[model samples]
Structure formats: C-alpha cells, structure tokens
Target chain A: MSQATLNRLADAGFSGWTTVTGRTLAAYQAAVVRIGVALTFGGFLLREWPHRRVLYGDLSPWSGDLARQMLASNHAFTVLAWSDGRWWFEGVYAAAIAVSVLMLLGWRTRATSLLFMVLVLSLQNRAVLVGDGGDNVIHLMAIYLAFTRCGQVWSLDARAARRGTRRTGDPVGVVVWAALGLALAYCQLSGFASLGMLDFGLYSWGTFFWLCWLLAGLRGLLARRAPEGEGLALLDALATLVHNAAMLVIAAEVCFIYATAGWYKIQGSLWQGGTALWYPLHLHYFEPWPGLADGLSGSSTLVTAITYGTVIAQVGFPFLVFNRRIKNVMLTLMIAEHLGIAIVLGLPFFSLAMITADAVFLPTGFLARLGQGVARGVARIAATPVVRQTIMRAPRTPERDPEAVSVIR
Target chain B: MADEPDEATSPEPIPPLAETPDLPDEERRWSLPSLLVLYLTAVAVAVAVVYHLGTVFLSIAPANPVSQRHATAINAHVLPEFEQNWQLFAPNPLQQNIAVQARVQTVDSTGHRLDSPWIDLTARDVAAIRGNPLPSHVNQNQLRRAWDYYTAWHDQQTEKSTGFGGPLSEEYLKRIGLQRIGRDWEGMAVIQIQFRSATTDVTGPSWTGAPATTSPSYRQLPWWPANDDDYRGLGVS
Candidate 1:
C-alpha cells in the first residue's frame, strides 16, 4: 500500500471514532454490573457454606487425608499436599469462606475480593483430584472481579456517607474499560479450555454463555457514551464493535457445544432409554437414594422421556435463546435439571455453581433492583459512627488515595 | 513567523463538551508497578492457603482398620501362593493351570494361628485365604457376592457345553463343601486357585523356497510336571 493510502485509511479510522449512536452502550454497562454483582454474591455464598459436606457427605474428610499422602510422597506436584486433611487446611478453608462472605456483604469489599480469590484458588490448585470445571471457572472469575472495580456501584463501601459522592474521572473509565477486556478474555479462555482442548462437549451451551458475558462486558466499557447521539468517541465505537464480536463468538461456541454433544449422545443406546442417567445415580459415591434404583426399574417410559428431554435440551439450547420467552423457559428448565442432578446425583456444589452462571440469563432490571435494595441496606448500616470509625482505623498505606476510594463510590 | 494570522483570526481550540471529564493528575491510573504487586500478592496468598490445607489431609489413616489390615495381610500371603502355582512365561506362551489347597487357621488373642473347632468353611478365592466374609464388612460382602456370581456362571457355562465332564463329581463336591452352613465360618480362611493362559504368536518373513506361502504352526501343551523346587523357590513351601 502507498503511504498516501495508508494515511487516508488512518484518517478515516480516526474520524470514525467521533460518531456516537444508540442506547446500546448503557445497556451493556447495566448488564455487566448486574451480572458481576450476582456472580459475586453466588460465589461468596458457595465459599462460605460448608460446601464439602453438602456435596461429598462424610467422605469429604477423605480430601484432606489424600492431601497428606501426596505430601509424604514428596512428588514434584507437592502442592497437592496443601489439601491434606488437616486442621490447618480446614482453617484456611474456613478463612477463605469467611472472606468470600465478607465480600458479598460489601464490608471491605476490595480486600475481601482479593482474599477470597487467593484462598479459593489456593484450595483449588492444591487438589486436582477433587476439582471439577465449575471450581476452576469460579476461581478465575473471582480473580478477574478482584482486579475490576466490581464493588463500585453495588457495594456497602460505595454507600458510606462519609466516603462522599462517587468521583468521576478518566482513570475510572479506563479501569472499567480494562476490566471489560479482561472479562472477555477470561470467558473466551475458559471456553477454549473446556470446548477446544478438554472437549467437554458442553460447547453449545458454553458458546451462548460466552456471548452473554462478552455483551455484558462491552456494555460496561461503553457506558459513558451518550445513547442515541452523534459524535461518538473512538473508545465507544471500539467498545461497540468488541461487544458485537463477543455476541457472535458466544453464538458460535454454543452451537458447537450442542451439535457435538448431541451427536456423541446419539451414538449411545443407553441415552435413548435414559439408562445413562441411572449410571450416575447408581454410583455408590454419588447416589442419594440407592433404593430408588430398584423402584425405578419398571419406569421405562419416564426414563425414555428424561433421556429424550436431556438430548433435546442440550442440542436446542442455543437456538432457543434467540426468542426471549423460549430463552426464559429453557433457562428455567436448565436450572431445574441442574437442581435434580445435584440432589439425586449428589453433585450439589457443582450444581449450585452452574446455576449461578446461568443467572446471567436473568433480566438486568431485576438484578439492578436487587442491587438497589442491597445498597440501601448498606447505607443504613454505614450511618453508625462506630462503623465509620472502625473502617477508618483499618491499616492503609498512604498510596491508597482517599480520592481513588471515592471514585468507586 | 512574520506572516502569521492575527491572534483573534487564529481562533481558540474547541473545548471538549462538559461531561464526566478526566482527572487532572495522570497518576490516578493504576500504575503498572502497583498492579504487578497486587497480582503477586494474590498468587502468594493463594499458594500459602493451599500449602496449609494439604498437610492436614494427609495424616489420617484409612477408616476401617480391621478390614484394611486383613487386606494387607492377604496380599502378603497370596503373593507367595500366586508365585508357587503360576508359571512365569514358558513353553512358548505359558498356559498352565494349577489347583491350590489349604486349611484355615484362625489367630486367637494369644497370638497363635490355630484351627478353630467352632468354624466350618468352604474354599473361596486366593484373597479370602487370610479371612472369611464378615457380615459387617461392605467390601468383604461385595467380594463374596462376586465370587458367588462367578461360580454360578462358570457352572452354568460348563453344564451347557457338550464336551465338559458331567456336573462336578460327587467326590469333588465332598472335598469342597456346598453352601456355607453357619456363622462359625466368619473368621476362618479358605483356599482357592485361578487358571490363566498367556499366548504369543510370532511370525517371520516367508522363506524363499518352493512354497513361499507355507506358514509355521505351533501350540504349547497345558500340562506340565509339578516341581517341588519351583514351589520352594516361590517361598511358599
């Protein structure tokens, strides 16, 4: 290309930045903030709850014991020892749970986010033997949320009267933009990890999940741009383009998951009759009611229906999301499906985390209302002088600017 | 410089619209150094938490000591028995079947391995030689159930075959008793044996002869003379 042509192209690109458009940007921000808060709440609840016992029963103790053996083996991956069933490990687990709960409560929100991420990641990394994909996804999301100003809008810290009004500036916008980018990267990486390499075959559903997440991120990044106006900033345009691209990626990913999984299941005879469901339900480690298997032996029709329903849902989930009513119906079905698996198949924690992710499909307005209620409650608590004094007394470095804190408000 | 337009004609730069404006100080943007520190701190904290949890999990012993100990003891005892009756690869693909015979000796609180008059038992499998089925033991019960299934299935298959010996002879039935009769069998050991075959097929390039198509055929017989020396060598004499 000639220098003149290149200069022309650059000039055109520069000029494209000045044109602003519709309510798309604000829509994006509202979606991202709502989703972020919901995830924060869900993840915190899981961490704080005695999830091990809920999921694994008394056998949960085995996780710690296994850790000890791995340590004594002096294996190269000795970090596995960290999960060894010991009092110290329990203490660490408890502390992590505590921090996550604190995060949800919006008390020292940033500090808790950091602590929760560290604790959860540490526990997860130490024991590959005990982990599922849900654990890894939650861990990664926690890390991303930690770096982002996730607590800025919905948190108790933001509601504090003494903290003054929320500060507005270029840096805050830049950080928000960066966070949006990070969120996109995180979801895409997770999708690639599960579908591309791991061949989880959940790609069909995962694609939709990713697109939703990407759109949500883009919305946040472009929030400052005026809705339905001219002279859009370069950043706003870039944000919109990225957001749209993410939606496409999400759709493609979901399609891949459904098609691949559907085909795989078609090859199995047990899936046709729902015998496949029985396998997980019968597994001694996970079975909630072993006696139920004997009673269900005559229910061939029920079994077949469940099998057919599962396959249809798996394959049809992506396309269904295009229609709002159908999407809501399918989402409800998926949630119920997960709930059944958790209780009947003995995978409660996994089910809970998955349900949390599916919460993205919920209306942003509903989430925003929930956030508003939480903020009001926080404001009431912050009115006390004792609470204010306690917060002020917390150890902080001089570099931790009061101004920077105010921007989050 | 001399021919420049007048100050008023030069025109002032357009001021940006009044909106959420940028902070005056650029230092407000999170510094790269600070971000790096935060990232490192997060990782360090995670590592510490993992390390602390691992130590706690490893120290506990398996939940069922009696059964676990029994399993370990059986492994030790059966390892020798396996070596004695089973041949290493031999005869161009070892195919050997040897029967094992033994009596149960229960250990009392006094530490003596003595035959208990109260117990009457039947032979099961090699793993069961260290102890009989315990009603309270889930693993032991499962193993017993599996042994029963195998025995019944094997008998049915043998009976259906045209060339098999008539249902196991009365003499053999007398030697290995029928269905275990009483609770006295609980801690008593029984002897059992398994028959396995290993075969290898080797082929070389066709020889340049009158008939290049001809292939060699080889088969090793099943029966081999018992060697007392082999049993001693196995540390099971």
Candidate 2:
C-alpha cells in the first residue's frame, strides 16, 4: 500500500479506538434493558413464591443430585448445585430476589450485574424443566448485560456520578467484593461442588467467572492506585470495546430470534394456509381469557391477518433494521404483538422478556422522553402533602451528563 | 434531537469521524507502537465479531449441510448454556390437548393388589393456569415439557427408548407422578405407577366449518416400579 493510504488507515483505526474508549453507546437503551429484565425475572420470582418449594426447593421432583448431574454433564453452572439441602436452596432463592432488586435500582451495578447473572443462571438451571421461552431470553441477556456499562444512566451510580461522589472507598462495595472473594476461595479449596473452577474445561462457565472476578479486581486496584494513569485508561478502553461489542451482539441476537422464528413459520404449512394462529387460541391451557380468545378467533380474516402480520414482521425485521422509520414502525408492531400474546396466551413472563429484549433496539429519543416523564411523575407524587408529611421526599431532577448522552458510532 | 438520525439502525453502522470524541491531547499524540496496537486490536475485534455472529447465525438457522457439517463445533459453542430453538409456533403450533393421567397399583394390609383410579395430572396443571394471570412456571411447563421430553426420548408406537435421554426423562416423569399423587390411601404401599396420555385435537374455528375430531387417542406406557428414592423424596413411606 502507498504511504498515504497506510497513514489514512492508521488514523481511522486510532479514531475508532478513541470512540470505543470515550463513551458507552445507547446509555438510555441499556438502562431500559436493565430495568425491564430485572423487573420481568424478579416479578416472575415473586409471582411464583407460593409454589417455590414444588418448583425449585427440596420438594422438587427433580432432586438436587439430579440437577447437579445434569448440569455437570451439560457443562452449566449454578450455585444451587453446591448443596442438596433445603436451606441452601432457600438461601440462593432469597439472595436472587435481593440481587434482582439491587440491580433493578441500579445500586452498585458493576457488581450487582454480575450477581444478577449468577442468580438468574442458578435458579433457571436448578429447574430446567420448568421454564418457557421467556426464561431462555432472560438466561442469555443476563450474561450479555453484565458486560455492558448499563448503569451509565438512569441509575443510582449515574446520580452519584452527577453529584461528584466517587465510590473509591464505598464500604458496601468493599464488603461484597471481599465476601465473594472468600466464597470463591471456599468453593475452590473444598472441591465439594465442582463449581467448574477445578475443571478449567473449555466452555466452562466457571472459567468465565474466574476471569470476570480477576479482571474486576485488577480494575479496582488500578483505579485506586492510579486513577488517571495510562493503565486505567487502557483497561477502560478495553472494557468499552467489550461493552460496545456485547451491545451489538445483543441487538443481533434479537434479530436472529425474530428472523429464525419468522423464517421457520414461512416453511410451515399451517402458517402458509394462514390459520396457524387459530390453534393456540382454542387450546384450553393457553386460553386465559377464553371469551376474548373466542371472540378474536371467530373471524377468519383476523386470524389470517395476525398470522401473516406476525410472519412478515419477524422475517422482514433483520433486513429493515437499516431503515430507521420502518424499523421503528415494525418495533411498535412487535411490542403490540407481544402484548396481545401476553393477554391472550397467558404468557406474561414470555412477552415481558421479549419486550425487554426489544427495548435494547428502542429509539434513544423515546427512551429519553420516557425517563423524563417518569421523573416528573415521581417528583409530582413526592410533592403531594400526604406523601411529603409521611416518609416520601421529592427528588431533584437528575442533571443529564453530556458524556452519557453523547453517542459514539 | 438533530442526532436522532445517528441511531444504530444497522448492526455496526459507523457515523462520520467528526462525531467521534477527541481524546486528551496527551493520549491523542500516541507513539507509533501504540498506534500499531490500536490497529491490531480493532482488527481483532472485527474478526471476533464476525466469527461470533456467524456461529449464532448457524445456531439459529434451519437445518442445512453447512450447519450439519459443523454440528459438533456448533454444539460445543451453543449447547447447555446458549442452546436455543426459535420454532415458537413453526412446523405447526400444538393443536391437541394431551392430558397425562397416572394410576398406581398398591398392596393394602390385607394383601390385596388394587389399582387406584386415574388421576389427571395435566387437568390439575390446566386448572392452576386457567383463571390465573401469572401462573407459576411449574404449572405452565413442568408437567407439559416433562411429557414432551419423555415423548421425544421414547418411540410413540413401541414405547421404546430411542435415545440416551429416555431413561432420565422416564425417571423425571415418574418422580413427578409420585410427588403429585402423594399417598392418598392410608396403609397402602404403592408398588407401580403407569401413565396414559389422552390427546384430543382442537376443533377448528366456527367460521371455517372445519370438521371436528373430538375423539381422543390414548398412549399408555408400561408399568414402572416406584422406587425408594421416589417414595423417600415425598416422605411417602
């Protein structure tokens, strides 16, 4: 290559590196994802609290030993497999709920995000036979969400950042890190639960956790020692690169879900005949609102329209992502379709999960306005005399951080 | 929102360099070696992204020679953790309601071998889900997916093990039956349990005037001995 061409390429590469290191992409969208996912999984857990024992506790038919065997053979990870006792199960279950709430409120999200991933995986893997499509989406997104700087906006961390409060010596964070470090040591030394750490096998989630823990510790040390040094900047740049890459993967994963679902439907004769949706409506198990389902399915044209619309949306979604207006229109349609599914099919969790995954691709302006509107509503509620006299206090509107808002393409 | 047009519409659409944030003066004036490192890292990221997406695509796409040829590699990448199936309602959505009923043979104190009446496990699950807006995952998928798992691992006609997952699924279903059944009859020790699934095809919409096949077909499994672990888990003994 000519000297000029090579120099141009090098300049472009350096610019790209700067962009990756300078700012997180789609901060509002990531916050929406954090809130939506945490709500869906956490809400599902609370909803199923009454049946917790039969679902995942010691009373579960799929015994702990059985789950452990399956998990080991499948190369999956879960702390629930650490013991066969009911107390262990209860501890993990309760911790999962607490972690979910923490992550939802975006408190110490850098750590809570990782814990959120672990708890989601632990509970889901404990009773693999008991989940639906929604559980699958949560399973994947929890892992991806950990890598992104999702708490950059609309979070307690963001608020602290705006207030110029550093977490350099935060006691709670230090305690959590120390506690987890001790737990890892115990699990590793005991060798009682495998924990995937000992195997160091390819595809072992244990390996992933160890690497995450080590990297987090290194980053923490670097920040404490030399916050403004080149080492910290380099680490931050690498993290940003991973974050951007993970966000892209998340978006592509959503498209793949829709594309595959849509393409598969096209090959099905039932979908081709435009009566595929008619069956689920009549199934007794799926008919949460039988009267509503009956009324909707009574019209052949409605059935055909829905079936075709669903297929067309799914198949065309990946291709239309390049067109902003069309993609937004289709995104609305998809969200509405999920709402319809939630009501008609009695799969609220599944629908919520899908909607949350779709939120990652939501237009930034809409999400920003949504955040503002919510803030205004909360401030209004807190200002009421009845609430103010009691314990509720009005919150000052958070100052928008320019760094958080700036989009780096 | 003038920059609204800059939203990510495609997978990795890079905007104009003018929008790129300028680094600090010190970092901007990097050594040649640092510049080389940046170029290499950027190239590495691009390659990694392409390879990861390709694997994901192959994982989700329909069965083809390319995917089949790399099934082992794909399985390693996607199985257990990332394994996914997007056939939401494809090939055909379920049009049949399959109710799994379990009957147990027990020996009373009088030494008489009597068979208990069939208890519809699926009806119980369906009942739990019917009026509830947020049915538990156990109610929605436990018994249903258990049956699907069992059937997938066993042949329909011969009711024979077809794969390695057959026996595990059998134990899983049996344990579910044992737990759900409990110990109804006092002083009776349950010896064996059997499951019979009655599947009825859903009637077509009234507008279509499609013929209804309401008659149910039965798939009965051979009797399975209720072992000590099953009884012990439920404190049945």
Candidate 3:
C-alpha cells in the first residue's frame, strides 16, 4: 500500500466515520429487536420449561460424567458446566431467567442488557448442540445491544425516568442536579464494572478519572473552536457511532447469510434442475404432517416456482436493499417466504428470529407508525373508566423530558 | 488586535472553577477536563468501532479464495458463539428421514437375555412438536443434532473434514440413547442403539421418471456398557 493510497483510505475511513453523525437514525428502532428477541426467548423458555430439568438440570440423561467428557472434547465453556449440582444449576438457571425478564421490561437496561448477554452465553454455551440458526443470530444481537441506549423508550426504566423528571420542579435546582449526577454515576458504574472495566490492575479507577480531569484541564487551555449551540455531546456521539455501527454490522450479517445461501444453491445441480424444492417436501424429518407436505409437493409448477422464487429472493435480497421500492417488494416476499418456512418446516423460532432481525432494517417511519397504532389502541382501551383508573392511578401530568435533568457533567 | 475590545468595553479575567457552579455540562466544554474527556472518548470510540467491525467482518466473511487467506484470524475471532455457517437446508435440502431407535439387552443372574423393546425417540419428538405452535429447544434441535453428531463421527466422508470419534460424540450418543428409555433398567447392563434412514431421489412434482425410493437402511452400533443414570425424561415422555 503506497502512502498516497493509504492517505486516500484514511480519508475515506474518516469520512465514513463522520457520516453517521449527520445521518438520520432512530435509536428507538432497536426496541423492535429487543421486544422480538425477548418474546421469542420467553416463548422458548415456556415451551422448554417442562423439559428443563432433563435437558439442563442435574437429572439430565447426559450424566455429569458424560457431559464432562463431552465438554472436554468440545472445548466449550459455560458457567453451568462448572457444577452439576442440582441446587447450583437451578439457582443460576433461575437467575438467568429473571435477568432476561428484567432486560425485557427495560428495568435498569444497561445492567440488565449486560446480564442478558451473559445469560444467553451461559445457557446457549451449556448446550451447544441444541441451538439452531435462531440461537446464533440472538447471540450476536445480544452482545451488540449492550452498546445501545436501548432503554430510551418503551421501557419501565424510561417510564420511571420520565416520571421522576416530572415530579421535580423547574429552575432545575442544585440538589436535583447533584442527585441526578449521583444516579448517573451509580448506574453507569454498575454497567462499567459488569463489563469488567473496573478490573484495570494497579491503577485505581479514581486515578483514571483524575487523569481525565488533568487532560480536560490541559484541553481547556486550548482556544474554543466549535460552532455555537454545538453541544459537543462527545459521549452521545460515541454511543450513536457504536449503535449505528452495530446495526449496520448485524444487517450485513443477515444479508451475507442470504447471499451465501443463494450463491451455494446456485452452485447445486438440483437447484438448476428446479427440483430442489422437491427434496425438503419429501424429507421426513422436516415433514411435520405428511398430508400437508405431500399436498404442497403435488404441484410441479408450484414447486418449481417456489424453488425459483426462494433462490431469486435470497440471491437478490442484498442488491434490492439499495433501492427503496425494490427493497420493499423483496423484503415483503422474503418475510412471506420465512413464514412459509415456519409453517412448512415447523420451525417457528428460526423464522421469527430471521424476521425480527430483518425488522431492524425496516424504515423508522414504518416502525413509528406501528408504535403509534399500538399506543392508540392502548389509549382507546384505557377509556374504560375502571381499566383507566387501575392502570393510570397517577393523576394526569404532562410527561416531562428525562434528559432535562441531566445537567451534571 | 483588530478583534480586541477598547478600554470602554474591556472583558474581565476568567473566574476559577469553585465559583462557577452554575455552568451546565455543555457550557463547561471549553474547560480542560471536558475537552480531555471528549478527545479521550473519541479515541476510545474509534478503537472500539474498529475492533467490533473487524470481528463482525470476519464473522460474516464471504466464502471465497480471498477469505481463505485470513481463515485463521477469522476462526479465532469468531470461534464458538459467533462462528457462522450458512448451511441450514441450503443448496440442497435433506432427502432422508432418519429415525434413531434404541433397545436394550439385559442379563439376569441366570445369564438369560431379557430384552427391552425398541423405543422410537424421534417419534416422540415428532408427536410432541407436530401440531404444537411452540416447540421446545430440545424438540427443535436435540435429536437431530445428536444424530448429526453420531454420523459426523461415523461417516467416512466427514472424517476427511472434521476428524471424528471424539469424546463429545461418545457421550452424545449415550445421552440420546439413554434419554429414550429413561436411562434406568434394573437388570440391563448393556444398551444397543440403531438408526434407520429412509431416502428417495426427489421426483419431479409430476412424480414421473420411473419413481424411485431407496429402502430404509438400518445402521446399528455395538452394545455399550450401560449405567443406571436415568433421570426422569422431559415430561413429554
């Protein structure tokens, strides 16, 4: 790489990094992934609840000895694998479930999101063989979510923050600022420590803070240069960068999954013959209902069309995303195809998982409308006097901006 | 010089921090502390963004000769949790229906061969999951994976890629077979397991081309020493 070429690359990278600052982003859009993932996991838990003991409990058919031997060969690690004791397993298992619920409700989201990631890692790691494509997508998404302001809206934490702000009076008193600072410190520190930042050996965390102060002091001596009303929002900018970057990364992941699948299908002789669809229809493991499977397999024209349609959709999905109209047409068909897979293959979680991940690419406007419609429905239901009184016990006061109280440095 | 104020409009020297409690976070940006924080934060973000994108790139890398060069780094970065492959009913869907069944041979004090009847483990899964909207993870993945693990070890072709006969497979088959019988048999000292795979060449939707279906072939494993390690099976049984 020549210096000029390197310079050009650096310039390009710098431009790409700055573009997110100007681009339109709806952080709240991530709520869809959160809600979808939580519901899917919750549904998974409920379905797996009865069998939990046998699958993961101390009483599992895979005895402790067998499991240890298996783990020794596999080189996979999980906190659950540390012990096969029933009580220890149950406690850790229960804690994972509770943390997931808390994360779903968006209570102390930063902390809960971290815990949720750990839980997914621990549980999924414990049984490596028993996870499908759905588990893979969720695993990556959980870690990506840790960097986001995922609790910005539609969460219990958001609601409480809003409520707390409303209860405080204007002039934004000194006490309020101090209290807010303390709260921010507490919450942020919890998240930081959970992420293992507090483990910086030799140097105390306070020293790091002191160094930052010294740097800020030296930086203060430099002349101010930013345009007026530009809040710097340095931390906010970092958060946005990370959040957007993750979204892009995950979206790329989904696209590549489709592209590779399509590309491989393109390579296969069966697909070229247009008889590729005939196999899955006949596969007994996938055949949940023989009558239905055979019923669908009866039409050669339908089968060929579907086979070609799936290939075309998966192959074209990446290209289509660059064009709005085409993207909409393609995504609709893709979603439908996944739904079809769910019904035909009897893999609801896998389909829903893909659909949920795809939902991230859905236009913010569409999600906003969906959110509004849901809110409207809730409001309409609340019109019933008894229901309204029960759910809305707090007397009506205008909702306040939670960020208004964030006056502390 | 040109921007300086005259004697009539001279500005006061800046006040010390202890006297400036009223300054909000943004107003204090010109301070050395906040600017230092901002610069440090930007640097941190840059490093983090680079690391994350690098890992993600490797994880979702395209399958090509170019990517093969970085295969080791990609593998290290994406091993375990993020390791990805796009091979779910891909290019070609499976044409075989494999049923894993387990039966036991028991010996009494008289050395008589008492037999435990064959149990269709996959059948129970099919029945439990067939009409149900939400299938348990066990139903979704366990038996299929168990069979896959077994075959991956046993298959001659797979051995060329992923070497087989690891302890994982050894324990894995035992777990799956034992799960079928609830693991406990008072007199059973040994267990035997087998599978039947029924395959058919996919005929056209027209069902023409001299319709061909291969007879289901049975593959059995040698009897393994049994342990009385039966925990109650998932309540589905």
Candidate 4:
C-alpha cells in the first residue's frame, strides 16, 4: 500500500479503538443482564435447597467418583468433586448463593463476578444431568459476565465511585480480597490446580484467576501512585476495550443460540408439517396442565401459526438485530413465548433464564426510562402516610444529582 | 468503525471517556509514542475478537469438515465448560412417550427366591410434576435424561453396550431405580435387576386421522446382576 493509504488505515484504526476504549458500550443493558442472571440463578439455588443433597450433594445418585470419571473425560472443572463429605458440598452450595446475591446487588462486582462464575460452574458441572437449557445459558453467561464492567451503572460500586469514596481502606473489601488471594495461593501451591481438568494451558481457570488477581493489584497500586498518569490511563483503556468486546460476544452468542435452534428445526419433518408444537403438549412429562395444553392444541390454526412463527422469528433474529424496530418486535415476541412456557409448561426457571438472556438485546432508552419510572414509583409509595411512618424513623435525605452517578466511565 | 462488532442499533455515538462530563480532568491528546502503543493494542484486540468468535461459530454451527478439521482445537475451546446445544426440540419433537419399568429379584434368609412386580418409575416422575406449579429440576429431568443418555450410549436392537458410557449409564439408571425403591425390600438381599421401556406413539389431533396405536411396544433388557458397585453410595449396599 502507498503511504497515503497506510496513513488512512492507521488513522481509522486509531479512532475506532478510541471509541471502544474511551467509554463502555451498552452499559445499562449489561447492568440489567448482570442483575437478571444473578437473580435467576440465586432463585434456582434457594428453590432447590430442600433437595440439595439429592440433586448435588453426597446423597445424590451421581456420586463424587462418578462425577470425577465424567469430568476427567470431559475435562470439566468443579470444586465439589474435590471431596465427597456432606459438609464440603453444603459449604460450596451456600457460598454460591451468597456470591450470587452479591453479584445481583453489584457489590465489588469485579471480585464477585469471578466467584459467581466459579460457583455456577462448580455446582452445575457436579450434577450435569440434573440441569436443563436454563443451566447452560447461565453457565456461559456467567463466564462472559466476568469480563464485562457490568457494574458501571446501577450498582453499589458505581454509587461509591460517584461519591468519590475509594474502597482502599474499607476493612470488608480488604478482608475479601485477602481471603481470595490466600485461597488461590493454596490451590496453586497444592496439587489442586494441577488436576488436569480443563488443561487448555493459557485458557485454564488457574491462569485466569491468577491474572485477574495480579491485574487488580496492579490497578490499585497505579491508582494510588499516579492516578492521572498515562499508565493508569492506558490500563483503564484496555479494561474498556475488554468490556466492549465481551458485550459484543454476548450478543453474538444469543444470536447463535436462536439461529442454530431455528435452522435445525427446519430440517425436521414435524416442523415442516407445521404441527411440531402439538406433540410436546400431549406428552405426560411436558403437560403440567392437561386442560390448558388440550385447550391450546384444540385449534389447528393456532398451533400451526405458532409453530411456524417460532421458527421464522428465531431464524430471522440474527439478521433482524441490525434493524431497531424489528429487533424490538422480535424481543417482545420472544419474551412473551418464555412467559407462556413458564405458565403453561411449568418450566419457570428455564423461562426466566431465557428472558434474562433476551434482556441484553433491549434498547437503552427503554431501560433508562424503566429505571426512572421505578424510582418515581418508589418515591410515591414511600410518600404515603402509613407506609412512611412505618418505614422511616428519621428525616429523609435530599436526592443526589442523577448525571453524576449515571456516567458510564 | 462499521466493522467493529458493536451493536449497530445505538441511536447515537457516545462521547469519548475523556470528554464525558463527570470524568476527572486529564490530557485529551496522546503523545506520538503512546499513540503508537494504543494503535498496536487495538490491532491485537481486534485479532483476538475475530479468533474467539470464529471458534464459537464453528462450535455452534452444524458439524462439518471445517469443524472436523479443527475438531481438537474446537473441542479444547468448547468442551465441558462452554459446550452448548440449542437444538431445543429440533430435527423432530418427541413423538413418543416412553415409560421405563424396573423389577428386582430378592432372596429371603432361607434362599427362597421372589420376583417383585415391575414398577413404573417414569410414572412416579410424572406424578410429582402433575399438580405442582413449580416442579424441581431433579423431578423434571434426571430420570428422563438418564434414559435418553443410556439409549444414546447403547444399541436399541441388540441391547448391547456401545461405548465407555454404556456401562456408566447403566450404573446411573440402576442407582436412580434403587433410590426410588428405598427400604421397601428391607431384609431381602436384592440379587438381580432388569429394565424395560414401553414406547407409545403420540398421535396428532383426531382431525388429522393419524393412525393411533393403543398398544405400546415393549423392549426388555436381560437381567443385570446387582453387585455392590451398583448399590454403592445409594445407601443400599
């Protein structure tokens, strides 16, 4: 290429990188996804608490030995397989719930996100057969959520950042960090990290965790030493770049899920005949409400339309995402389908999880409006005399400026 | 930046971080050396993004020679941790209802032989899921998928183990059956076990005149010896 062409390419690349590194993209959407995933998984854990032993604990049909053999062949990693004791299983399950709540509230999101990913992988991989489609969605999203700066908005971390209160001297934050460091070090020094599970060299959890810890430490040091220097600026830019890339990856992943499902259905003779949706309604396992399933399938036209619509909507999803209006329409349709699945099919968690995944495609303007509407609604409720007296024991504080806290960077 | 893998539907471009209203005061223009470093970093990130997405696409797309040629690399990228199949009721929705039944042979203290009736384990799962608005995942999927896994690893015609997972699946199915039976066979030592599945076709709406078969075809397997290993960890050994 000529000198002028080279110069143009360099300039274009520089500006593109600048946009990605300068500010986090889809900040509101990412925060919502973080909340949705955390809530869904947390709710799932609590609901299954009574059957924890049968589902994932030592009392389960899938013993630790069986899980180990399976994991060895598949190269999966899970801390639950480290021991077969009842106490060990209970402890890990409880920690998973705790971290999930922390992630939902977006407290110390960078650390909590990693813990959330690990726990989700641990429990889900332990009883691989006990999960459905929802578990798979959470499994992949949890890992991707770690790479995102999802707490940039609508989070306690963001609130602290806006208030100019650094967490450097916070005792709770310090203890959490130290504890994680010690645990990770022990795993490394011992042979736990060398169990050959997920032995993808650089792509392994051992490398990922150690890298995150070191980077966080370096970020803290740089912030204190040269808060405004180019070194910190560069680090911030790189983090922004990663956050943007992760967000894009998430969107692509959702698209792939729908596209593959739709295309595969096209090859089926049942789907081609446009009567595919009727069979599941008649099955004993899927028919939670026999009357409802029967009533819905009674109409030949409705069943055919839905079966065809589902295939069309899912197949066109990836391409339609480029258009704003069509994308929103498809998003609404998909959410409605999930709601129907929850009520009629009795797969509430699976429906909730699919809805959460669809939330990433929601428009930013709508989310901002939602947040404001919620704030106003809460204020109105609190203003009522009976509720106000019951909830408030002191004078209410003044509201802070919204712009200050709403900044994405 | 059209080639950037960003959401194209953003109504407006956001301002750069340095220029945002709430950002701390800092230098906007970069030095030539810093600019060079930033340019190289951008190139590297773009390359990584492409490579990662390529592998993900290969994993999700229908299997072919491209995915096969790169099978080892793709498996390393997607197995166990990131493995996904979104073929939700695809290629064909299930058109049959399969009921798995198991029976046990137990010996009394005097060595008297007795055979228990075949118990419909799948019906038990269906009962648990019937009226409950929120059925547990264990009730909804464990046995159903275990049977599916077992069949996937074993041949239906000859009923022979097909792969390493065949025996594993048998152990899994046996444990589930034993757990359900509980202490019903208390003092008698169960010596043998066998499984059979009745498959009934799900006919379409009556208007379609799809020929319905009222009788379910049965596939029964030979008796499998109940060793200590099958009962291990199930609290029955």
Off by over 4 Å in 2: A1-14, A195-198, A201-203, A393-409, B1-27, B31-44, B235-237
TM per candidate: 0.40, 0.90, 0.75, 0.90
lDDT of 2 by residue, A1-409 (tens): 9999999999997666567755567777778888889999999889988878778888887887677767768867677777778788888889889988978988777778988998998888888888889999999989889888777667776666555454444544556677777776677778855646335655465566677677767766665677656655565666667778888888999999999999999999889999999999988778878888989998899999999999999999999877989988988999999999998999999999999998888877777777778989999977655455444442333643334234221
**Who wins the lDDT comparison?**
4
lDDT of 1 by residue, B50-126 (tens): 43222211111122554354555433322211111111011111111112222233445555554423221212332
iRMSD, all candidates: 23.7, 8.1, 13.3, 7.4
Question: In model 1, what is the error at residue A48, expressed in angstroms?
Answer: 10
Give model 3's TM-score versus the native structure.
Answer: 0.75
Q: Considering only chain A, what is the TM-score of each predicted structure?
A: 0.52, 0.91, 0.73, 0.91
What DockQ was computed for model 1?
A: 0.02
Clashing pairs in 3: A216-B32, A216-B33, A217-B32, A217-B33, A220-B32
On the 0 to 100 scale, the lDDT of residue A366 in model 1 is 56
Candidate 1 error regions (>4 Å): A1-91, A107-111, A132-137, A143-149, A158-263, A273-275, A290-298, A369-409, B1-237
lDDT by residue for model 2 (B171-191), tens: 889988998887544558788
For candidate 2, what is the lDDT?
A: 0.78
True contacts kept of 3: 0.33
Candidate 4 ranges beyond 4 A from true positions = A1-14, A165-171, A192-194, A197-200, A383-409, B1-27, B31-37, B227-229, B235-237
Ranked by lDDT, the better of candidates 1 and 3 is 3
List residue ranges in candidate 3 displaced over 4 A: A1-24, A62-77, A165-233, A385-409, B1-63, B155-165, B183-206, B209-214, B229-237
